[model samples]
Target chain A: MADTQLEADVTVNAVGSSCPGPLMELVGNAKDVDPGTVIRLQSSNEGTEPDVAEWSEESGNELLDVVDRGDHWDLYVRIDD
Target chain B: MTANRPSVLVLGAGAGGTMTANALRRRLDADVTVIDKGRTHRYQPAYYLIPFDYMELADQERDTRELLHDEVSFVEDEVTGIDPDDRRVEGEADSYEYDVLITAVGNDRRPDAVPGMLEGWNRTDSVYPFYHASAAAALGDAVDEFDGGRFLVTVPDTPIKCGGAPLKLTMLMEEHIRKRGLRDDAELVMTKPGAEVFGTGPKAPYQERIEEIWDERDITFVPEFTVSEVDYEEQVVRSAEGDSLEYDLYAPVPPQYGHEFVVENSPLTDGGEYVSVDDNTLQHETYPEVFALGDNADVPTSRTASAARKQSHVVVDNVERYLDGRSPAPDYDGYTACPILTEEGKAMIAEFDYEDSISAPIVSRLNWFLDVNVIPSLYWNVWMRGYDPVP
Candidate 1:
């Protein structure tokens, strides 16, 4: 999937936050949104990528794509029902 | 020897062990004994400031015998193995038996774990692993003499004690360079194996504040750059990802791991490097009589002295309950505090528990004073003496 093609239902700006911060924010927002809701998490912390991927797998959510934006990362996740 | 008076054996007279032993001595009628190889107990928190000559090694050093309560027995022996099944710990000098065991033998520094790191420290003038006392003192001289070029600090990809220490050291070095009128000539750089500078979870506020501070100071932060080797002869550090950076001076936090006795000899760790304890109760999963705290415990939190201080309280309470034939309480919430010194007189107290951040992420002189001036004194007088009113 292309980075610019998909539109997120919710966006979490977690830039300048580290490890569990981005992941925590993602989890927090993911809980409030609907099951099929697509969320975009932008984070500068490098660990967030793997953490989000692991969380998605463990939580049974769909990780759409991970985009490198030079300075930060954009991770798209579809919440599971 | 009697059912009424149980004997407690504590391992390693470090922060957690010392505090727990002293507290247990006062609270319970049980006979408490602490076994450690070292005669001197060094205040490890002051290691970061030693490079800047903020605190002396002598001032931080105290005899192990002096720290413990008079009623508590102090055994000077190097632990060779631990037999949880037999309720015994084998030391180099002799084997000791115990009714209850608390393992707090903190992690070991292994510069040799990384290729060329140990060689770099020995052979080159530039390489200084500042976690060690001698290296910290030597870095002071190196810092004094350094005029220009890249002043780099690297954190190893390990769950290190005081996770915020590398960040504090990096920022302090940047400030030092600026103060010496070498900011324009020298490049300040810090590398971590992970993406963040300080950490994540409830540390978002502090991490954000640190990012802003680093940006204003022009201190470069390199993420996911795990140091593979230090080419001391060429004055360059190569990362596992094939990236290399040349430096004029380097202070690297050495790779740390649990002692072989705990991980290899004892079944307490349950095949992990550290003593595998319940994060909340701090009791060994398989052995109810076994408890672990401090850097040695596999707690999902920053392994700071502050965390150990808090854990000490819970461990003491749980041990008391255990002696009274009660179930251990889940008291420890993974609470830890890191006083991040942004500059000489400025710091931010990043305090947090398992789920959330508790302290405001505000940099101030008061916080700096609390960390540098008050904490050390309190550590020696109150906390070490087992008179922790705060806990």
Candidate 2:
């Protein structure tokens, strides 16, 4: 997925949050949105990729893509219906 | 006019409460008071170092009253309940009223939460929960007598104050064993409930370095081991998944939780283990006049004195603002730090806030010196006195 082309319904800026912080923020924000809503999570913590991946798989959410932004990462996820 | 002055009541006289009270007393013209059940304030970071005889237990202890500012009143009373609605705190000795309340009562170590753990500590000399001051002292003797065998250190599933303490203790023990020429006979092992040795994210660099260090030193790292029971009779620690590891000596970090009064009696927590506060502002969610910091606050960060020191500045600022009829700002960034002692003389610092890792992941003797030599002095003189120059 092209970074500029894709858009998200919600963007969670957990830039400096480590491990569970970014994942927690993503989950918290995802809960308020409707099912199938695409959310973008920005994080600086390296553990977020695998954690979000595992969480998405376990929770039956769609992990659209993970883009590395030099200093941080932007992970896209779609809430399960 | 005197009655119009706002009164601030702080719960617990530990690092958080003392710093909060002292800072508030210095900043505000309000009546600042600290209530705690314990008489002595212990430097808890030294608990791991105490086992190695690196720090004296007596030196780490101070009278709670002595730590507070002269303007701040110290009440030695066990808190029984908190009525946030009426703004009253009930203690075993007396009841007190406050215009503003700040709960900083730290975690309670519960060894009995795990079956046979308490018995092992009491009946056998093999088990030690080094988180407790007395237990840490006792572990010193145990370490001295241990010549060779499987030396095991376990971390609890609960949220502990210093998350890196068990790792530090494990590494220090490995170094001690190697120096004693017991390296061949001694098998050093550390266990955590999670996959990561320390933690992931901002702690990744430090964790990677720790992994390499452990591999080089022949120290065993066991992950996903949730301590279910400590079998004293068999000298083994069993995990929730039915896996068991036999040990000649054991040092386990016991499960920790909030005080019963705060968790059960007070509506401040809203049926949670910690006080339900706005994580950023450090203010109580429902009560504008209430704030929380330290281990008792439900903030998603590692509980440490460093974190409390940072929170003190925010809490004090917000409390003063609230008294002056101003809205509290979301200034706190969930910053916390852990100085991971890799060996006897070398250490690495993992410092981070909500947004990013602040410290470089490098192990050095200077880090050790700062942690061992400098931080404690600063903790007592500057931090406990609420003379923090760095926010």
TM-score, prediction 2: 0.82
Write the residue-wise lDDT of candidate 1 on B279-328 in tens digits: 99999899999999999999999998889999999899998888888999
Residue B171 C-alpha lDDT in model 1 = 86
True contacts kept of 1: 0.00
- For residues A35-79, what per-residue lDDT tens digits would candidate 2 score against the true structure? 989999988777889888887886778889999997679999999
Docking quality category of candidate 1 according to DockQ thresholds: incorrect
Docking class of 2: incorrect
True contacts kept of each: 0.00, 0.00
* Lowest lDDT block of 10, candidate 1 chain B: B116-125
lDDT for position B216 in model 2: 94
Q: Candidate 1 residues A21-78, lDDT tens each?
A: 4665576566456799999998876788888887788678888999999767889999
